[model samples]
Target: MAREVLAGRMGLREAVRVGAYADALADRVGAARHEYERQSPESRAGEEAEARRYLAGLRSEIDAERAPSRR
Candidate 1:
């Protein structure tokens, strides 16, 4: 990507900066979201449920991979 930027590839540098900015923004948002969720017990429960729902599929896949029988 840096090579492409140095090779006079238009927009590559800006694109990389934009992607980096987006990643930083996402990290900030995630931190703020967790902090917001931690502010109230009820809200924390709701947020945890929402997180579990989101992660359920991935968790199932991972559990399947790590199942004791598989080991």
Candidate 2:
């Protein structure tokens, strides 16, 4: 995704920044999933739901940024 966003295009600085953001988000999602799995059964259900909601929001943000803008 970051590669697509940066494709053929960015200066070194911009590419680095984009890469950092992608890495951070990936780490966050991984940590969240791991934590969710480690929770008690009752808590796991709520945490899993929250993780899904957060992931959906992340997807929406990515899609919105990638979409072509209106003039």
Candidate 3:
């Protein structure tokens, strides 16, 4: 969160707001994970790998964005 603010992706006040909502966000993530786990292996086939790749791409995008601006 602090990194986001330092990277200029989020302001301090927005970070504080996100902090306040963190618990709720965590709960939702947990619920989603639980539901995903409940799915049969056949139904979930290939999804975990796809999700991992998607998340890795997002991380790369964020890292690129956080790099010092050339301009």
Candidate 4:
């Protein structure tokens, strides 16, 4: 991507900013994976269930938003 900037594809400032954001996001994902891997099996199961519930709630909210409004 830095090379893309040199090739006149994107401005240097935008490329640097985007690269920094991607790096930060990857770091966060790596940390989360590390933490999850260190958990006990039972704890991991509980975490998975909780995540599922949270995602289901989000799906419901999105569905409600997309529904047509009643008069």
CA lDDT, every prediction?
Answer: 0.75, 0.78, 0.83, 0.85
Q: Higher-TM-score candidate among 3 and 4?
A: 4
Please name the candidate that would achieve the greatest TM-score relative to the true structure: 4
Error of 4 at 27 (Å): 2.4
Which lDDT value does model 2 have at 17?
Answer: 68
Total clashing pairs for each candidate: 0, 0, 0, 0
Q: Which ten residues in a row have the lowest lDDT in candidate 2?
A: 8-17
Considering lDDT, which of the candidate structures 1 and 4 is the better prediction for this target?
4
TM accuracy, model 3: 0.41
Position 23, candidate 1: lDDT: 83
Clashing pairs in 4: none
Model 4 C-alpha lDDT per residue in residues 1-71, reported as the tens digit of each score: 65777799888667657967568667889999999889999999998899999999999999999999997
Off by over 4 Å in 4: 1-17
* Error at 66, model 4, angstroms: 1.2
- Stretches of candidate 1 off by over 4 Å are 1-38, 59-71
Query: Over the stretch 1-71, how does candidate 1's per-residue lDDT look in tens digits?
Result: 45556677745547457777558667889999888866888877888899998799899989988887842
> What is the full ranking by lDDT, best candidate first?
4, 3, 2, 1
C-alpha TM-scores of all predictions: 0.34, 0.46, 0.41, 0.62
Question: What is candidate 3's lDDT per residue for 14-67, written digit by digit as tens?
Answer: 776785556666788899999998999977877877888999999999999999
Clashes of 4: 0
The digit string of per-residue lDDT tens for model 2 on 1-71 reads 45645585555556546767668777989998898678899987887799999999999999999999988
